[model samples]
Target: MQLEITGHHLEVTESMSNYIREKAERLKRHFDQVMKIHFILEVEKQRHKAEATFHVNGNHLFADAYADDMYAAIDALTDKLDRQIVKHKEKVKDHHRQEAAQLVAATETTD
Candidate 1:
């Protein structure tokens, strides 16, 4: 998956880039089909904000958090992203199950 990191109102550092890349890679342990991740980091008025968008097949998941530290915000956002990915997975699975059940029922009727 491609990971794109950008900073607004802040300078990008190697440490920050590595950290984001690590966190983004962890998503693979949950859902391996993630196509890309876009991370936006911003700081304003002593508040650090982190936003992450995950791109999947025909689905998009997003999470954001704000805290006194950028690292903390990134941590919280990753947790939120995990939950969103899980939910999306469940929804997609449910949709396919429903479709499969309908097909099975139609075949049984014809038989």
Candidate 2:
């Protein structure tokens, strides 16, 4: 998956980019369908904000967090998105499994 990181008020440094990259890579463990991730980091006064937008299939999952520091903000946002990805994955897998079973039962009954 492609990861695009940008900053509004703060300079996008190598360490910042690496941190975002490292954090985003963990999402692949949840769903390999993740196509791209867009991260926007900005500092609003004393609050450091991190927002991540995950592009998967035709859907998008967005998570944002703000803290006194940028790294902490990114970490919190990553954790939030992690939970969302896991939940979505389970829902889709279960739904598809149920559909497949129903289809197999219907075909067997017809025969």
Candidate 3:
């Protein structure tokens, strides 16, 4: 998976970049098919915002968070993305199970 981090209206320091990368790597544990992840960090007045777009296989998942601290915002964003990835995995599993059941039923009917 590719990770791209960009900052808007703020300079992305080395420590911050490393922190983001480390947090993002955790996602791979849940879903290995992640193709690309793009993160955008922005600071507007007192709000520090973090947003990420994830490309997993053929699906796109996105989440954003706002907090008073940049690290907190990134944490929130990752948590949201993790939940979305788990949900997506469940949906895909359920879809394949449903399809297999339907196929078995059709074959039994023909037999």
Candidate 4:
């Protein structure tokens, strides 16, 4: 998976970049289908905002967060994305399992 981090109106320091990369990597543990992740960090007055767009398989997931600190914003953003990825994985698994069960039942009836 590819991870792209961009900053708006703020400089992305080495430590900040590394922190974001580390947190983003955790998503792979839940769902490996992630293709690419684009993160945008912005500072507006007193608010630090973080937003990310994730490309997993054929689906796109997006989440945004705001906090007084950049690190906190990034943490919130990742947590939201994590939940979405898990939900997506569950849906895919359930769909395939249901289809397979139906197929088996149909084959048994035909035989």
lDDT (Cα atoms) of all candidates against the true structure: 0.90, 0.91, 0.95, 0.95
Which has the greatest TM-score?
A: 4
The list of candidate 2 runs beyond 4 A from truth reads 96-111
lDDT of 2 at 103: 100
The whole-model C-alpha lDDT of candidate 4 against the native structure comes to: 0.95
Candidate 4 stretches greater than 4 Å from native: 95-111
Q: Over the stretch 1-111, how does candidate 4's per-residue lDDT look in tens digits?
A: 999999999999999999998998898889988899999999999999999999999799999999999999999999999999999998777577889999999999999
Candidate 4, residue 90: lDDT: 83
Give TM per candidate: 0.83, 0.84, 0.85, 0.86
TM-score of 3: 0.85
Predicted candidate 1 versus true structure: per-residue lDDT over 10-106, tens digit per residue = 9989999998888887777889998989999999898999998889999988889999999999999999998888888887776778899999999
Mind giving the per-residue lDDT tens digits that candidate 2 earns over 13-88? 9999988888888878879899999999999999999998999876799999999999999999999999999888
lDDT of 3 by residue, 3-111 (tens): 9999999999999999998998898899999999999999999999999999999799999999999999999999999999999998877677889999999999999
lDDT of 4 at 79: 98
> lDDT score of model 3?
0.95
